[model samples]
Target chain A: MSETAKSSALRGAAKSARVHVMRSQLGRVRGLGAAHGGTHHWWAERLTGIALVPLSLWFIYAALHLSGEPRSYVVRWAGNPINAALLAALVLATFHHAQLGLQAVVDDYIHHKRTRLVVLLLIRGAAALLALIALFAVLKLAISG
Target chain B: MKDIRDALMVGRTSDGRLVHRPLSPHLQVYRPQITSVLSILHRATGIALSVGTLLLVWWLAAAATGDAAYAGVSAFMRSPIGVLLLLGWTASLWYHFCAGLRHLGWDAGFGLDLPQVHRSGRAVVIAAAVLTLLTWIVGLAVM
Candidate 1:
């Protein structure tokens, strides 16, 4: 078989691999497209969530002790190398989880394709910005301490 | 239900005519039950926690910025409204945590039977409440 024929055959196999039903054709229906990387998204969300289980519990315990404490106290808390490291981990996991969860919410709630796309991008940007700002704060406090 | 019913999803036919799909029953149509309530609560608290991150970041930024900046945030946090927000966040955090664990269990093919599901749902609610109350109690005593 010619190279083109072989490649076309491979392409045909890939398209057929997709789950389809009778009276269905590609792009024939709206609101039926696969998320493509859905499993990855679900798995990553769970992984980050598992990491957060310990990180968040520890944070809550530490934060309770620091309640109504001064800014210097907070600085000292974050200044501890272990605290700083764990706190950094917490921030990253938090924003990542938040972004993924919020993205799912947006995907479900926003009916308009363009609106959903724009909102998702905005969420991605906001989560990154917040996470970076937090990490920066932790770094500054750790260094100053 | 009212707002959600707006903008029924439209499908395109082979010949390019628009066809709207039938709407799924909305929130108001459901009879309230523990399982359903907890499911909605899980998502609600997750979204709430996401919003709470803004305040967390704000406090951290204020502290890093300087004493004056931190003092400003401190004042707000001590205010009645700020205190309420903090309490709400703490509760939301705990609730989301418990519900999330329950979710993980279900994903792993556990506690999925009808009775087990209901049992776990109640457990999550109670656990979240106890945790939140304990945190605030400890927080005040330590403070």
Candidate 2:
């Protein structure tokens, strides 16, 4: 290869490598790829979603068993330790998953940044509050039963 | 609000001309597909399930309060409207459950091909119906 051409080629390769490094550094600085906190949210949704599978099925079975039964029967059912634990797990996971999914929908459809933020906060807050109430009910019955 | 609306209105040039913007394609622009229908249903069912959870809260609260309170809630549940709501809740629960399985499958890198996607979508509907029926039948029979 000609000396000038070889030197220029080496210089070009070095410059390109530097550019690649800088680009990655810039990406890191941007922090979590635009959405800021998507991975954990997504993972939590998926995990809770999966956990809901058997829990939901169990809930359905248990609920159906209580169908047409007396109030005392239903209350007694809830008081069972195993039943209460399962119910609590299902309620928590289902609400958490719902919140995550709703957050995703709001984020995608609500183009107005301020509105999106407000909606997300409202959803999260409501989900947490409802979940707490549900869990407390389950615990109260389970304990006193 | 008026100023915001004015700012949002497409664009205006100093020469007093307004620039036209191209309209984006929306739901009408695309042909309906199973995946799309199921996707929308997933969201709808999710919302329904959230509402249905209130019933759970009510039942628990009633039971905790007293026998009379529980009877009031239980009576309403035995009414025709209550039965219908229960049926709806059951369907919503199973539908969401099955569709959720489909989602989990996709997340795990399975049934993502076009044909498989359609098959799973159909499966979700069928499974939900069958499940709802089975639960109700067994429930009523034993009751």
Candidate 3:
């Protein structure tokens, strides 16, 4: 209905007595079904975020140390086994957290169904692709020496 | 139209009548406050850092490629635009970090009250600023 009609028909709509909704539903259509994600998404976002707290702080400290260093210096730095492993962990956690956060934004803001789907896919796909690239790059650097 | 006939907010009543449903993004409806603003900023910075991941991968790709490629990427990093982008990313990262800790605190059932909430909001901003400046100073000033 047009907004005018909807507005005009509001005679006691707020308190308008019993509408026969299902026993466990807000409407006849029931929602998009059990979603299946549930608390998994919530828990993963937080877990990855928690992992990133240290990973990212370490990166910042390492980055400052390498700020003005040359190509060889960076190469040597990343080549270390410990640094390589931490770097890999950081890559995985960062992208995982990032895509989750991006997904939440798209879910909340993009009301259009198809557009939301496409945007969500794009962001997630980019996150995955970039993460793989970063991991492989770190691996290559580690082994290049 | 009563001003916004939001399609998603359009719902059908029991007697086949049409009515408006409620949803959010009504952020403008409320007065601006520090707590809400910081909450929003946390998400905003998160999105920013997500985009900044592109640069991180690019830098890594350059490093993996070879000496010339690494030098090229390093030159770009030392450039003005690159520095500006890095600075923006740095600020966002630290801010998001601080705000994220506050969120974790709330999740763990700490600092739920209004006074603590507002106080922590201010603390997040201050800590982020200090950390960012310290990082850049160390990045540029120290060995």
Candidate 4:
């Protein structure tokens, strides 16, 4: 084959490859499932991240104000309907976000298959239990106070 | 050193990359930048928050257990060191919260430009500091 023809053929092949890559990337961006679980996880993390901003700030304000207060005072404060409702929301969102973030860390670092699975489960369980306990305590205070 | 050796021996994968394996451009090779520090802080705060949740569990369990236990926990919380930890936790919470907001912004297709990235990072740091100070001031007043 002539050198000019050979170079032209190579150029054509490169162009086709570039086009293929562009199409695949567009498909992945559209979330046709080629990207697997990443898009969902990313979306969830962002949603939770947005939620936690105000909820966390409110929690900090609530906690700081309670500093140096007596137990009864805290209980009474928490018993207020608005505070109780916000506290529940804060705990739930915090725990959910925590679990998702920690899961990413665990999946990133933990190497042993069994250990990774166990650690992931443990993280999920711990977050869930903490949320439950916090919610229950808030409810108890709200009711009993 | 031992952990590094063990990791190499095990030949583990982290984030789809080989861990502790012979690779070009290790973390040490790159100079530390603000973004790098912020990224590390994000993970550090995450781990701290995980541990801090246990403290929450303790407080709730104490409340569930009854008045005396609750009082004991409350008393401890009022102590100097406890107060310091509480303050630290509060700061961590604020910093993490602000950084998380930055991450959300990035995820939502904002702040990807270099100038915006740096600006957002600075914003996160400033917001966290201001919020922490404001909360502390209010706390002192309430107390």
Candidate 5:
């Protein structure tokens, strides 16, 4: 190649390399990238974690109260509008947080990429199924009452 | 003094890609500490709680199904085996809950010091125990 052409190509290569490095650095600073993405996952996990505090306490208390109660009593307790609303909130938050936590755990320990993806999907599916079941039960009681 | 290449063994896989099996430190290489043990327990209890959710779904389903189904489930739940399972689930729930709070504390820039970490680790266990016991006592009393 001609001297000018060779020099121009070298400069272009250097500029491209610099741009690549700059993009990676920017990614690191912005907390978003191919590897880590943004902090949304972290923030969502914490938000749900915090929500679980009150919901979990309420659930334990309610569950304990319902223990050994007759079918009619359970139907009545669950049919209460306030109780149904709280139970719905609890199920949604619990399943959402559980899905996020399980995804993190599986991603951390399961090394095989394909296996990790499958497990994460399975976790989400199971959480959704359970959530649906809980919600349906609450709705049944609420409507039938 | 020794050859460095001996420490860096790279083998070609069947797909013709080079791979290195790193000799990284694992659980056996270090002494057990409160923080590390608690970390493992945190994961364990999380899994336990996930399984417990299934039981919750079953109870809710039975309740929604009808009187006979609810009666069957309620009977099992009050049985010896069922009570034991419930107790374990209760303990796991509280442990996970306490550990989760500790994690939030770390995220909020508190309890990051080594001593504080250890203290909080201990606190999580104690709180879980106390809470579990209190819940069961009150639960049984009201029953």
Candidate 6:
């Protein structure tokens, strides 16, 4: 065969290989069905990333001011509605983002399959628990004070 | 011959090599860049936030447990070392927050070019500093 013909054949082979890989990927997608589990976690992380830009700055200011205050004064400041709301938002966003990021780290670096799974679960569970407790405290203070 | 036990075991290949496939290379080969460093910092802040959450929980738990526990935490917060750590954590939070916004921009198909990436990276740093300083100023004013 001519060199041109051989080149054309090689191109055809490459095309076929690409198509095969695409089909295999499609098959995997079909098998997985409508179980898009990580989407909300990802969206929450991104949303927090955006929210944190302002919230984090506010948190820093709030923390610095609170640095020298007595327990009663600090509690009263946090009990204010605006401060309480912002603090609650910050805690929630921080925990959500931390969970997503830690999950990615566990997936990437942990070699022991079982341990990796456990760690991922623990990170997520801890994040949720912490957020809940913080929210409860914020609510209590916001309502009572 | 010395005996060695394989905790995760598969059979050897016919060529007498272990049948382990090489992992895709990680961040080793590429020279460190500002973007790369910022990316790592993003992860570090994430881990810090995880620990910070525990601190938040402690604070809340103290509040729940009553005045004595709350006073203990409040006293710690007043300590010089504790204040410094809080300041550092606050800075980390702001820095991470800015960098994360930059990352989100990149994810949305913006700022992918080399110049833009570096520019955004610099912006993240400068913005964080400006924010921290502003925060401290406001904090001192309130105090």
Question: TM-score, chain A, per candidate?
Answer: 0.75, 0.77, 0.75, 0.74, 0.75, 0.69
lDDT rank, highest first?
Answer: 1, 3, 5, 2, 4, 6
Error of 5 at A105 (Å): 1.1
lDDT per residue for candidate 3 within A101-124, as digits (tens), equals: 888888777888889889988988
Candidate 2, lDDT over the whole model: 0.83
lDDT of residue A8 for candidate 3: 64
Error of 6 at B121 (Å): 1.1
**lDDT preference between candidates 1 and 4, better one:** 1
Tell me the tens digit of each residue's lDDT in model 3 across B1-143.
Answer: 45564767888887899988877756678999998889899999998998899889998898888889888888888899999999999999999999999999999989999999999999999999999999988888954
Per-residue lDDT tens digits for candidate 4, residues A1-145, read 9999999999999999887764465565675542235667767767777887788768766766776666778778877899989878878887888888898888777778889889989999989988998889878878885
Q: Show model 1 residue runs off by greater than 4 Å.
A: A1-36, B1-24
Q: Flag regions of model 3 displaced more than 4 Å.
A: A1-36, B1-26
Fnat of candidate 3 is: 0.76
Clashing pairs in 5: none
Report how far off residue B32 is in candidate 4 (Å): 0.4
The number of clashing residue pairs in each candidate reads 0, 0, 0, 0, 0, 0
Q: Which residue runs of candidate 4 sit more than 4 Å off their true CA positions?
A: A1-36, B1-23
Model 4 has fnat of: 0.51
Error of 3 at B48 (Å): 0.7
Residue-level lDDT for A58 in candidate 3: 98
* DockQ (model 4, Cα): 0.43
After best superposition, candidate 1 residue B31: deviation in angstroms?
A: 0.8
Model 6 chain A lDDT-worst window of ten: A30-39
Highest-scoring model, DockQ: 1
The local lDDT score (0 to 100) that residue A86 gets in candidate 1 is: 91
User: Please, what are the lDDT tens digits per residue for candidate 1 over residues A28-121?
Assistant: 4542434424667889999999999999999998887677888888998889999999989999999999999998888777888888889999
Worst 10 residues of 3 chain A by lDDT: A27-36
Give the whole-model CA lDDT for all candidates, comma-separated: 0.88, 0.83, 0.87, 0.79, 0.86, 0.75
Lowest lDDT sum, 10 consecutive residues, model 4 chain A, at: A28-37
